[model samples]
Target: MTVILLRHGVSTSNVAHTLAGRSAGIDLTDRGREQAQALVQRLGSLPIEHIVCSPLLRCQRTVAPLADKLGIDVEPDERLLEVDYGDWTGRPLGELISEPLWKVVQRHASAAVFPGGEGLAQVQFRVVSALREHDAALARKHGGEVLWVACTHGDIIKSVIADAYGMHLDLFQRIVVEPASISVVRYTPTAPFVWRVNDTGSDLSTLAPPRDPAARSGPVPGGETGNTVSTDNEGVEHPDSHTE
Candidate 1:
């Protein structure tokens, strides 16, 4: 089966660089919508047989445009949500960077979670578990040739994909999932392999010469407009990220 992982669009929390993990009710920014729409224009043409998302409003809104475009319903899964931030939810990035624990988390970034937040290992276990369940379903349904999409947070999606390739937590920083980015993976129950991880809006290459550099600098015609299409939220995972 082939799985595509996507981060939600920009949210209010993202504006301040705050940790919006598991914080409820946040919505996508206008730019975020444009990004999602761009993704829709890019992938909407694919035979997207399945879609799962985190339940957070940002993720919901992010995927809604695509669902509307594709005429498909998002399958919300709780297990795919962001890891809980504990007391760190809604905290500003500056404050988090100042704390000693945050420093430890940086060094042991993948292992040192917040005081009350879910551990990286645990988060990986559950998220991968959910993924495996889906894989089984897809394998059974399509004989292992199914294409699926799971929209999730930056860290949650990154950790699982990286660990699958023997990458360490400190390496997590290297796999940056810009808001509204897409990561693709192809896996089988027995032998799994990662195809691509965390490709951003800038990575797309489909184009034809319009003979105008100025026009090329802007969003591709009939493509998503690029006006800071990100959102403010946990910058990480969501509870309903399956929105699960």
Candidate 2:
């Protein structure tokens, strides 16, 4: 199964450089609404069977246009919501940077826990588990591979990408998920393939699965020679290059 991770577009908090962190009444900025509309043109061609999104309004608005175009009902999934920043909710990013925990969040996210809020490790676990569960359910429902979208927040998308690369949670900061950007992961029996990350504009039609059923499974003979991003096994499991 393939899951496309889409970050919500720029929000009012984003314009103010604040950590929205599950706060209420946060809406998309004008630019963000435009980006949401653009998603129809960007992803309309893909065979997306389902649309699951964070319950937050920002995420709901982000996927609205595409869902309308596709005529699909958007299902709200709490697990896809943004990180619960607890006391840090509504705090400006600049102010949060001055806190002592900022360093830990950047360098050792696995050990970082927000005061009165959930931990980064906890965020990763829930989001990954939700994705895998959804993937399994979709596969069973379709009786084969399927494509779907998960509209969510930045940190959640980054953590999911980190897991797809088999990287430690501490290294998730190295991955960047821009507002309204799209990342993709294909889960197989052997491993999860990180096909695209932080992709704002590109020919996504290549993601369409081949018509041949037999061509879908197994690895390529020459290790998938083409314009693709993947991990290296050169004494490390992390991605060798950054995905923008």
Candidate 3:
């Protein structure tokens, strides 16, 4: 089974460095829409049989173009929802420290929970369960010819990948998930293998930048991570009130 995790394109929260925190209804920006188009064109060449979308606007928007290309509707699932950030909603990392359980959450994700939110163990339960079930369904449906796309947020995607591969959160925190990027994993009918990580729309094989001396390379340089949609995290909440 082959599973490709994709972070949604740019959104309002990305530009402000604030927590979206399971806030529903955020929409994709113009550039984000374009990024989705790029994903369609790039991955269009691959034999994609199914798409899993979070019940959020950014994810739906991100997968819409790809669904058009595949001639299939996105399969929505509530388990893919982002973490509920509770009191930290709309606040940036700096201000988020003021939240009640921020310290515990930052240290031991498994033990942390927002005021009115979920714990890391709970988040992992749903996300991981969703993934396994999706794998089973896709395997039965497509056999070997399957490319499943999951439109999800930064933290959730990171946590799913990290937990699946047994990576430490420290490394997970450093890994970035840019807008409309493609992170790939493949399990050969038995075990899972993460073949690639956070590849942006700009990294599309067909549209990837030329290997020139000036080509922007190596982790996309810090401070340049912000926009309307993007981030480097795992086990985080979704943004609120998206539209697009």
Candidate 4:
């Protein structure tokens, strides 16, 4: 199955430079709505079978244009929700940077837990597991060949990319996911392939309809999971390169 992970467009909090986290009432900005519409234009041609988005309003607003254009309902999944920032939920980024916990968040995030919310590890587990479950379910539903989109938050998207690359949570800081950016990952029985990361372009015509329909069961001879190919975005095991 092919999963397109997208960060929601910029929100009101984004322009204010505040940590939106899971805070309610944060909606997309006018430019954010335009960005979402641009994303729809970029990916409108793909045969997207499913659209899953975080329960957050920002995410819902981000994918709304695409969902409407494609005539597909957006499935709100809490697992795709933004990380709970706890006390830092609505705090300004400039101020949070001075807090002692900020150092840990920037350096040793694996051990950094929010004052009253989740740790990076906990967030990673929840988001990645949710993605894996959805991928497996879609594979089963579409005969192991499917195209779906997951609209979520920056940190959530980064964590999933880190898991795909098999990198330690401590190194997740090196991975950057910008708002409204799109990343693609394909999971097979044997390995996973990273297609695009934080890409604002790429129509993704090369990803749809399964490169080799039969390869969904296992690695194929001249397809995505094949060892013979050495493309940058080809199948890569974890810990080597987190984002291709």
Q: Which candidate is the best by lDDT?
A: 2
Task: Please report, as a residue range, the 10-residue window in candidate 3 with the lowest summed lDDT.
Answer: 223-232
Query: Candidate 2 on 145-220: residue-level lDDT in tens?
Result: 8999999998899999999899999999988777888898888888898888888877787676556655456357
Q: Ten-residue segment with the worst summed lDDT in candidate 2?
A: 235-244
Per-prediction TM-score to the true structure, in the order listed: 0.79, 0.90, 0.77, 0.87
For model 1, residues 202-241, the per-residue Cα lDDT tens digits are: 3322222123434334444675433223322334332221
Q: Rank the candidates by TM-score, best first.
A: 2, 4, 1, 3
Candidate lDDT scores, in order, read 0.70, 0.84, 0.67, 0.79
Q: Give one digit per residue, the lDDT tens place, for model 4 in 69-137.
A: 999999999999888888888887878888999888878879989999889899999988898899999
Highest-scoring model, TM-score: 2
Q: Candidate 1, 207: how far from true, in Å?
A: 18
lDDT of 1: 0.70
Candidates in order: C-alpha RMSD to true structure: 10.0, 5.8, 9.2, 5.7
Model 4 vs. true fold: TM? 0.87
